[model samples]
Target: MAGKKRSFGRVRKLPSGRYQARYLGADGVDRPAPHTFRTKRDADDWLAERQAELRAGDWSDPDAGKIPFGTYAATWITERGIGASTADLYRSLLRNHLDPTFGTVAVADITSARVRAWRVARLDAGAGPSTVAKSYALLRAVLMTAVDDRLIRRNPCRVKGASSAVTPERPTATVQEVYAIADAIQPRYRALVLLAAFSGLRWGELIGLRRRDLDLTANTLRVRRNIAELHSGKRLIKEPKSAAGKRTVAIPAVILSDLSAHLTVFAEHGADGGVFIGAKGAAPRRNHFNRLWRKACHQAGIKGLHFHDLRHTGNTLAAATGASTRELMTRMGHSTARAALIYQHATAERERLIGNAVSAAVEQARKQAPGPNGHAAGT
Candidate 1:
């Protein structure tokens, strides 16, 4: 007797004694199973799973994820509407780290095991922790988009703690070292070094400063723009990273005269003129400044200090002044309290002062408290 008709798909015997399954998809196209099965029952079982997926609304076009990962990632980056500098960074990460592994692979073909292996290989190859973290984050972000697009069921970047990198502690410079570097550096950059250290202005903010942004009379420096210099020597001037980044920061009283001198002697002309510039009337480049920084450090007898250390020192010093977390966040141009809390370390000197104050408060309370019989406690 003839068998009962199948419901969703057709199973046919191949010439090699294998069974192939073909099914009509939601798109009204007949799609063959990717591989042949040894038995007709197995082929029917595979088709049954596809039918179940369709019924549950989890069915996706198998060909949709056939696009190469590199192609999808490039399109993803372009459609992200990110800033130029950020685009540059993502491109660099893709080119240097991710593309070599998954470039030609189909988006759906990437597996969690492959991702883990790739990360382990990168770590074994001596890639910096931060670089690896950034790359892994980028990979995960791209794969997540694929999942959203329904090109893949899930992201394969499932490694725990792979996106966070543990960077070593950054070194900070002292007041004496700051002055020594300032004096040792060229005359034009003297104010720049001192202002960076005291005002805690980032390199981009300092470079983007204009004459109109400074009001020495009020001892406040306005941060309106940030100049980012890419690795290719291209400069992009954009708004601050966050709303808090565009704020008015108090300039240290000691550096007011130096800033005045810098404006008069080195700064460009007009109210919109640049505040900090190179010796040849050009914007300061990071590479050029690094050479000058090295010489300055040598002359100052300071070692292992980065220019950012100056800002770190300033933040730490601000915290030392008993500045509240809100105050520190405002001064540091950070939108989050966690970023500010990192600088709020209690030094031994500050701890001692706090202890002394607490002890004094206790003594005063003891002296003023009423005794059991209504006499003063101390008496």
Candidate 2:
């Protein structure tokens, strides 16, 4: 039934006198190698390696990884305990980028070469670098889970630095530009422009705000929840993406009047009602907001500015306040220095002021120094 000795494998001679390698696995079932070897020694060697792996507790059950990549990947994504938006993103990437190639492929059959080939084909087929990178990263994460499950001994998505996308620097609007955009938008959304450019709130967080979220006297907005609008016109009010994302950001006192006016004129609901609303008294979704965003940019003479650029403008303005790196991170709800460091660079206006001050200092030094003789006595 089981092997003669549990520690070592038992070999048998096949019908054609070839040796067959078989071992009683941890499951107490006799399993043979995929192929028979010509010599007993060859079969013995294979069993020995398998035995060594078992002894070391590093043996991966071949049957464990027989699950299809798509099935297992979908399972992993669902049980990952991530946010809804994150799950939705993973599902999209798996469907759009990975499924065509690896859907029917067994997890055990996904070799490094196959993964590399899929990535190459995607890049050659006009997929953007960022898009491919995101998909590849998701693939890597799923394969890593397989490794943890002992379905695979190692992950095959091994292209180093393939996970990091080289994103172009986002354009930042100036203070005057932000004001112009605000003035050009519908009166109902004017405060939206000002708040986006001044408070540095993400669109999701801004649209999810209610009347009680704003503290006019304290000039602070509490970011408690965020809304993700689906393509089906459904909105999901979820917790902030990260622990740091649920933060209180202080609004500039300058926007106090504009915000007050917006509350009185536009926000007709009670304390628990949404701060921003459309004509139907519902919150503005992305598509509806996009139309207004386009109109405002067009009227402001800025042809290609996304709503996100206003947050960039606000972050740059905060940096201009000489805020420390930690301060910027807290304000922007970022946990990493990489994102904080982006706002550390001075804005164009601040740099101009520095340049002018440097020029004045040089002029004063030249005036004090003696001409040609380089003496302070002017000799």
Candidate 3:
């Protein structure tokens, strides 16, 4: 007897009780898909659903699988066109840390367990908690993109308590310590340190400063651009991180006076009339500043002082002077009040003074009142 003619394209029965449907795709191309069912009716139903999905352009092959997490992340990074330095750092983190652990893994396959394991491995390899946390954040960002692309149903890295590692505190230098270090710096760079401490400019902002940006009349400096050294052995001027970062900061009179003296005596006078040029009248490279800053710190007998710490010192001192959180945030160009609070929190001594005043008031009130023993005299 002749077998019944199959109506819904060619079909093959597998030993595992699954039906394979081979049909011409919407593109008029041949395609095959598999569905497991207990009976021919169920298999036909599954095939019908798949055909509807294909007709609606919503069909996805179960076997097509997701792109590897690392590949998808790389594409996302390139498409977003992050700054060169940021791109380099992300790629380095991915290649050195992430790729090795999860490069071959599909975006859909990532789970909380996998992320936890990656974090533990990084920690075991002596990676700092902050570094691990950053790596995890990058990974999570990649997974989030995967979800957005519909490559994955959800981000697996959003597990609760995933980033609970204790991050080490960033070191900060006191005002006096910073002053001593500034004193030890070569006379030419004294103003640079002072600018960093008083004006709260980042290292790049200070280096990228132009003579025009300094309004000696107004005692202000406009942070228009930042100089960064590319791996290509050249310096590049880039815009500030945000619109707020490209603001004019009023310099303290002392720092303003010092900057005036430096401009008169030592500034190399760049072609663009930059203020902080090197010996050859070009922007000072980070290497030169790094070496000079370390030597100055060493001579001043100050340990753990970083160039960026001067910015923090400025913020701390400003906060100590009762600068409102909003004022400090504006001055520091902080994107959030949370970061500004870190600087405010650094003013422990000022907070302690308030605590002492409260204590003194309590003591005076207690002395003026009768004690539990009904003594009216001062105790």
Measured by TM-score, the strongest candidate is 1
10 residues in a row with least lDDT, candidate 2: 1-10
Candidate 3 residue 3 C-alpha distance from true site, Å: 11
Alpha-carbon runs more than 4 Å astray in model 1: 1-5, 369-379
Clashes in model 1: which pairs?
none
Question: Could you tell me how far off, in angstroms, the CA of residue 263 lies in candidate 3 after the best superposition?
Answer: 1.3
lDDT of 2: 0.88
Number of backbone collisions per candidate = 0, 0, 0
Give the per-residue lDDT of model 2 (tens digit) for 307-368. 98899988888988878999999999987878878887766878888899999977777778
Cα error, residue 359 of model 1, in Å, equals 2.1
Sort the candidates on TM-score, descending order. 1, 2, 3
lDDT of candidate 3 over 1-379, digit per residue (tens): 2223565545666677665566655556666654455666666676687688787876554433467878887887898778887876788788888999889987777887888787888889998777777778788887777666656656778656555557666566876887898799888788888888877789888988878888888888788898777655666779988777878788888777788999988775653587876766667778777898999999998887789878877877788887888888788876678977877773568978989989998888777868689875565
For each candidate in the order shown, give its overall lDDT on alpha carbons.
0.92, 0.88, 0.76
C-alpha root-mean-square deviation, each candidate: 2.5, 4.4, 5.6
| Pairwise lDDT winner, candidates 2 and 3 | 2
What's each prediction's TM-score?
0.94, 0.86, 0.77
Using TM-score as the yardstick, the better of models 2 and 3 is 2
Provide the lowest-lDDT 10-residue window in model 1. 1-10
